[model samples]
Target: MNEPWNPYDVMPAARSADPAAAGARIDALPVSERWKRRFRLIAKAGGPRLPNLGALTFGERMAVMFSVLGLLFGPLYLLCKGLWRPALAYSLIIVAVGFAALMLGLEMLARGVGYGAAVLCANRACALYYRQRVLGERPWL
Candidate 1:
Protein backbone atom coordinates (compact mmCIF):
# COMPACT_ATOMS: atom_id res chain seq x y z
CA MET A 1 0.00 0.00 0.00
CA ASN A 2 1.00 3.60 -0.52
CA GLU A 3 2.38 5.55 2.44
CA PRO A 4 0.21 8.05 4.22
CA TRP A 5 0.63 11.79 3.79
CA ASN A 6 3.63 13.54 5.38
CA PRO A 7 5.42 10.28 4.70
CA TYR A 8 8.78 11.71 5.64
CA ASP A 9 7.39 12.89 8.98
CA VAL A 10 8.48 16.44 8.40
CA MET A 11 9.70 18.14 11.52
CA PRO A 12 11.51 21.33 12.44
CA ALA A 13 15.17 21.35 11.64
CA ALA A 14 17.93 21.45 14.25
CA ARG A 15 15.49 22.33 17.01
CA SER A 16 16.59 21.69 20.55
CA ALA A 17 14.16 20.77 23.36
CA ASP A 18 13.76 24.43 24.23
CA PRO A 19 10.56 26.06 22.98
CA ALA A 20 12.17 29.44 22.43
CA ALA A 21 15.01 27.92 20.47
CA ALA A 22 12.59 25.94 18.32
CA GLY A 23 10.47 28.98 17.57
CA ALA A 24 13.52 31.07 16.75
CA ARG A 25 14.61 28.66 14.02
CA ILE A 26 12.09 30.04 11.55
CA ASP A 27 14.61 32.73 10.70
CA ALA A 28 16.76 30.28 8.78
CA LEU A 29 14.20 29.69 6.02
CA PRO A 30 15.11 31.16 2.61
CA VAL A 31 12.20 33.64 2.49
CA SER A 32 12.70 37.33 3.11
CA GLU A 33 13.14 38.67 6.60
CA ARG A 34 9.67 40.17 6.39
CA TRP A 35 8.17 36.76 5.72
CA LYS A 36 10.33 35.19 8.39
CA ARG A 37 8.86 37.60 10.89
CA ARG A 38 5.35 36.75 9.78
CA PHE A 39 6.11 33.03 9.93
CA ARG A 40 7.38 33.43 13.46
CA LEU A 41 4.13 35.08 14.42
CA ILE A 42 2.25 32.24 12.72
CA ALA A 43 4.26 29.56 14.48
CA LYS A 44 3.57 31.15 17.84
CA ALA A 45 -0.15 30.90 17.20
CA GLY A 46 0.22 27.21 16.32
CA GLY A 47 0.35 27.82 12.55
CA PRO A 48 -1.26 30.28 10.15
CA ARG A 49 -4.98 30.01 10.49
CA LEU A 50 -7.10 32.99 9.54
CA PRO A 51 -6.56 36.06 11.61
CA ASN A 52 -9.13 36.81 14.27
CA LEU A 53 -9.07 40.55 13.81
CA GLY A 54 -10.34 41.27 17.31
CA ALA A 55 -7.87 38.93 18.98
CA LEU A 56 -4.72 40.15 17.31
CA THR A 57 -1.99 42.21 18.91
CA PHE A 58 -1.05 45.53 17.30
CA GLY A 59 1.64 44.05 15.13
CA GLU A 60 -0.58 41.24 13.92
CA ARG A 61 -3.38 43.66 13.26
CA MET A 62 -1.00 45.73 11.21
CA ALA A 63 -0.08 42.69 9.18
CA VAL A 64 -3.72 41.95 8.45
CA MET A 65 -4.30 45.57 7.49
CA PHE A 66 -1.25 45.56 5.26
CA SER A 67 -2.65 42.58 3.33
CA VAL A 68 -5.54 44.78 2.31
CA LEU A 69 -3.25 45.96 -0.47
CA GLY A 70 -4.11 42.66 -2.12
CA LEU A 71 -7.30 44.32 -3.32
CA LEU A 72 -5.16 46.22 -5.79
CA PHE A 73 -2.26 43.83 -6.30
CA GLY A 74 -4.02 40.50 -6.05
CA PRO A 75 -3.22 39.02 -9.41
CA LEU A 76 0.46 39.81 -9.17
CA TYR A 77 0.70 38.56 -5.63
CA LEU A 78 -1.17 35.38 -6.49
CA LEU A 79 1.09 34.69 -9.42
CA CYS A 80 4.22 35.30 -7.42
CA LYS A 81 3.01 32.91 -4.79
CA GLY A 82 2.65 30.20 -7.48
CA LEU A 83 -1.09 30.08 -7.02
CA TRP A 84 -1.96 30.33 -10.68
CA ARG A 85 -5.28 28.52 -10.41
CA PRO A 86 -6.63 31.04 -7.93
CA ALA A 87 -5.35 33.93 -10.02
CA LEU A 88 -7.21 32.60 -13.03
CA ALA A 89 -10.33 31.95 -10.98
CA TYR A 90 -10.31 35.49 -9.57
CA SER A 91 -9.92 36.99 -13.05
CA LEU A 92 -12.96 35.15 -14.28
CA ILE A 93 -15.01 36.14 -11.25
CA ILE A 94 -14.02 39.78 -11.66
CA VAL A 95 -15.04 39.79 -15.29
CA ALA A 96 -18.40 38.31 -14.41
CA VAL A 97 -18.90 40.91 -11.70
CA GLY A 98 -18.00 43.73 -14.06
CA PHE A 99 -20.44 42.51 -16.67
CA ALA A 100 -23.23 42.15 -14.16
CA ALA A 101 -22.56 45.60 -12.73
CA LEU A 102 -22.57 47.17 -16.15
CA MET A 103 -25.96 45.64 -16.81
CA LEU A 104 -27.21 47.03 -13.50
CA GLY A 105 -25.68 50.48 -13.98
CA LEU A 106 -23.46 49.93 -10.94
CA GLU A 107 -20.11 49.36 -12.61
CA MET A 108 -18.07 51.45 -10.22
CA LEU A 109 -19.29 49.70 -7.11
CA ALA A 110 -18.66 46.34 -8.74
CA ARG A 111 -15.01 47.21 -9.22
CA GLY A 112 -14.57 47.76 -5.51
CA VAL A 113 -16.47 44.61 -4.63
CA GLY A 114 -14.59 42.47 -7.12
CA TYR A 115 -11.22 43.70 -6.02
CA GLY A 116 -12.21 43.23 -2.40
CA ALA A 117 -12.83 39.59 -3.18
CA ALA A 118 -9.21 39.27 -4.13
CA VAL A 119 -8.06 40.21 -0.67
CA LEU A 120 -10.29 37.53 0.76
CA CYS A 121 -9.10 34.97 -1.75
CA ALA A 122 -5.50 35.86 -1.06
CA ASN A 123 -5.91 35.31 2.64
CA ARG A 124 -7.68 31.99 2.17
CA ALA A 125 -5.21 30.69 -0.37
CA CYS A 126 -2.21 31.56 1.75
CA ALA A 127 -3.74 29.96 4.78
CA LEU A 128 -4.58 26.82 2.85
CA TYR A 129 -1.10 26.67 1.40
CA TYR A 130 0.48 26.85 4.82
CA ARG A 131 -1.81 24.22 6.25
CA GLN A 132 -1.18 21.85 3.39
CA ARG A 133 2.57 22.25 3.49
CA VAL A 134 3.31 22.43 7.18
CA LEU A 135 0.52 20.49 8.82
CA GLY A 136 -0.05 17.96 6.05
CA GLU A 137 -3.72 18.79 5.89
CA ARG A 138 -5.59 16.83 3.26
CA PRO A 139 -5.29 17.89 -0.37
CA TRP A 140 -9.04 18.19 -0.93
CA LEU A 141 -9.33 21.00 1.56
Candidate 2:
Protein backbone atom coordinates (compact mmCIF):
# COMPACT_ATOMS: atom_id res chain seq x y z
CA MET A 1 0.00 0.00 0.00
CA ASN A 2 1.15 3.51 -0.79
CA GLU A 3 1.55 6.10 1.95
CA PRO A 4 -0.82 9.04 1.82
CA TRP A 5 0.62 12.41 0.93
CA ASN A 6 0.78 15.00 3.69
CA PRO A 7 0.75 18.61 2.60
CA TYR A 8 2.13 19.76 5.95
CA ASP A 9 5.19 17.55 5.51
CA VAL A 10 5.85 18.98 2.06
CA MET A 11 5.25 22.63 3.07
CA PRO A 12 8.21 24.94 3.51
CA ALA A 13 9.65 25.37 7.02
CA ALA A 14 9.96 29.16 6.78
CA ARG A 15 7.55 31.73 5.31
CA SER A 16 10.11 34.54 4.99
CA ALA A 17 11.03 33.27 1.55
CA ASP A 18 7.41 33.83 0.53
CA PRO A 19 6.66 37.20 2.12
CA ALA A 20 3.78 37.81 -0.27
CA ALA A 21 1.80 34.86 1.09
CA ALA A 22 2.53 35.97 4.65
CA GLY A 23 1.42 39.53 3.91
CA ALA A 24 -1.61 38.23 2.12
CA ARG A 25 -2.63 36.17 5.18
CA ILE A 26 -2.13 39.12 7.51
CA ASP A 27 -3.94 41.60 5.27
CA ALA A 28 -6.88 39.30 4.71
CA LEU A 29 -8.45 40.04 8.09
CA PRO A 30 -9.04 43.06 10.37
CA VAL A 31 -7.10 43.16 13.67
CA SER A 32 -10.19 43.02 15.96
CA GLU A 33 -11.53 39.94 14.13
CA ARG A 34 -9.77 37.59 16.54
CA TRP A 35 -11.30 39.17 19.63
CA LYS A 36 -14.73 39.19 17.96
CA ARG A 37 -14.39 35.49 17.28
CA ARG A 38 -13.49 34.92 20.93
CA PHE A 39 -16.48 37.01 22.10
CA ARG A 40 -18.81 35.04 19.85
CA LEU A 41 -17.53 31.79 21.33
CA ILE A 42 -18.09 33.12 24.86
CA ALA A 43 -21.64 34.23 24.07
CA LYS A 44 -22.38 30.89 22.47
CA ALA A 45 -21.23 29.19 25.68
CA GLY A 46 -23.86 31.33 27.55
CA GLY A 47 -21.67 34.11 28.92
CA PRO A 48 -18.32 35.86 28.71
CA ARG A 49 -17.80 35.77 32.49
CA LEU A 50 -17.42 32.85 34.88
CA PRO A 51 -19.81 32.40 37.81
CA ASN A 52 -18.49 32.26 41.38
CA LEU A 53 -20.70 29.21 42.06
CA GLY A 54 -18.72 26.99 39.65
CA ALA A 55 -21.54 26.96 37.16
CA LEU A 56 -20.66 28.39 33.75
CA THR A 57 -24.34 28.72 32.87
CA PHE A 58 -27.80 28.43 34.39
CA GLY A 59 -28.42 25.10 32.70
CA GLU A 60 -25.24 23.69 34.21
CA ARG A 61 -26.33 24.75 37.70
CA MET A 62 -29.73 23.09 37.31
CA ALA A 63 -28.17 19.91 35.91
CA VAL A 64 -25.69 19.66 38.78
CA MET A 65 -28.42 20.19 41.38
CA PHE A 66 -30.66 17.57 39.79
CA SER A 67 -27.83 15.08 39.53
CA VAL A 68 -27.02 15.49 43.22
CA LEU A 69 -30.68 15.04 44.15
CA GLY A 70 -30.99 11.92 42.02
CA LEU A 71 -27.81 10.49 43.48
CA LEU A 72 -29.28 10.99 46.94
CA PHE A 73 -32.35 8.85 46.17
CA GLY A 74 -31.69 6.62 43.15
CA PRO A 75 -30.28 3.73 45.21
CA LEU A 76 -33.27 3.54 47.53
CA TYR A 77 -35.45 1.95 44.87
CA LEU A 78 -33.55 -1.31 45.19
CA LEU A 79 -33.98 -1.72 48.97
CA CYS A 80 -36.72 -3.94 50.44
CA LYS A 81 -39.62 -2.45 52.40
CA GLY A 82 -38.35 -1.11 55.70
CA LEU A 83 -39.36 0.81 58.85
CA TRP A 84 -38.96 4.54 59.48
CA ARG A 85 -35.62 4.48 61.39
CA PRO A 86 -33.65 2.40 58.90
CA ALA A 87 -35.08 4.29 55.95
CA LEU A 88 -34.41 7.63 57.62
CA ALA A 89 -30.88 6.61 58.55
CA TYR A 90 -30.20 5.36 55.06
CA SER A 91 -31.56 8.54 53.53
CA LEU A 92 -29.48 10.70 55.86
CA ILE A 93 -26.32 8.74 55.11
CA ILE A 94 -26.85 8.95 51.40
CA VAL A 95 -27.52 12.69 51.53
CA ALA A 96 -24.51 13.28 53.75
CA VAL A 97 -22.21 11.32 51.49
CA GLY A 98 -23.65 12.86 48.37
CA PHE A 99 -23.29 16.38 49.77
CA ALA A 100 -19.69 15.69 50.75
CA ALA A 101 -18.93 14.39 47.28
CA LEU A 102 -20.71 17.33 45.69
CA MET A 103 -18.79 19.77 47.86
CA LEU A 104 -15.47 18.26 46.81
CA GLY A 105 -16.53 18.28 43.18
CA LEU A 106 -17.52 21.94 43.40
CA GLU A 107 -14.27 22.85 45.14
CA MET A 108 -12.19 21.17 42.46
CA LEU A 109 -14.30 22.77 39.77
CA ALA A 110 -13.85 26.23 41.31
CA ARG A 111 -10.11 25.68 41.60
CA GLY A 112 -9.90 24.67 37.96
CA VAL A 113 -11.88 27.72 36.87
CA GLY A 114 -9.71 29.98 39.01
CA TYR A 115 -6.55 28.43 37.59
CA GLY A 116 -7.71 28.92 34.02
CA ALA A 117 -8.78 32.52 34.69
CA ALA A 118 -5.45 33.21 36.37
CA VAL A 119 -3.54 31.83 33.40
CA LEU A 120 -5.56 33.88 30.95
CA CYS A 121 -5.16 37.07 33.01
CA ALA A 122 -1.43 36.42 33.41
CA ASN A 123 -0.98 36.05 29.68
CA ARG A 124 -2.90 39.23 29.07
CA ALA A 125 -0.84 41.07 31.68
CA CYS A 126 2.42 39.82 30.18
CA ALA A 127 1.34 40.90 26.74
CA LEU A 128 0.40 44.34 28.04
CA TYR A 129 3.68 44.66 29.96
CA TYR A 130 5.72 43.88 26.87
CA ARG A 131 3.75 46.28 24.74
CA GLN A 132 4.22 49.04 27.33
CA ARG A 133 7.95 48.31 27.62
CA VAL A 134 8.56 48.21 23.88
CA LEU A 135 5.82 50.26 22.20
CA GLY A 136 5.40 53.06 24.79
CA GLU A 137 2.06 51.64 26.06
CA ARG A 138 -0.64 52.10 23.45
CA PRO A 139 -3.33 50.60 25.69
CA TRP A 140 -2.72 47.09 24.40
CA LEU A 141 -5.57 45.40 26.25
Every model's TM-score: 0.58, 0.21
Cα lDDT listed for each candidate: 0.54, 0.33
Best by TM-score: 1
**Candidate 2, superposed: residue stretches over 4 Å from native:** 1-105, 138-140
Clashing pairs in 2: none
Candidate 1: minimum summed lDDT over ten consecutive residues — where?
10-19
Deviation from truth (RMSD, Å), model 2: 20.6
Give every collision pair in model 1. none
Q: Tell me the tens digit of each residue's lDDT in model 2 across 54-98.
A: 533565433222223223333232122112233345446545655
Give Cα distance to truth, residue 119, candidate 1, Å.
Answer: 3.9
Q: In model 2, what is the error at residue 10, expressed in angstroms?
A: 51
Instruction: Give the Å error, residue 86, model 2.
Output: 57
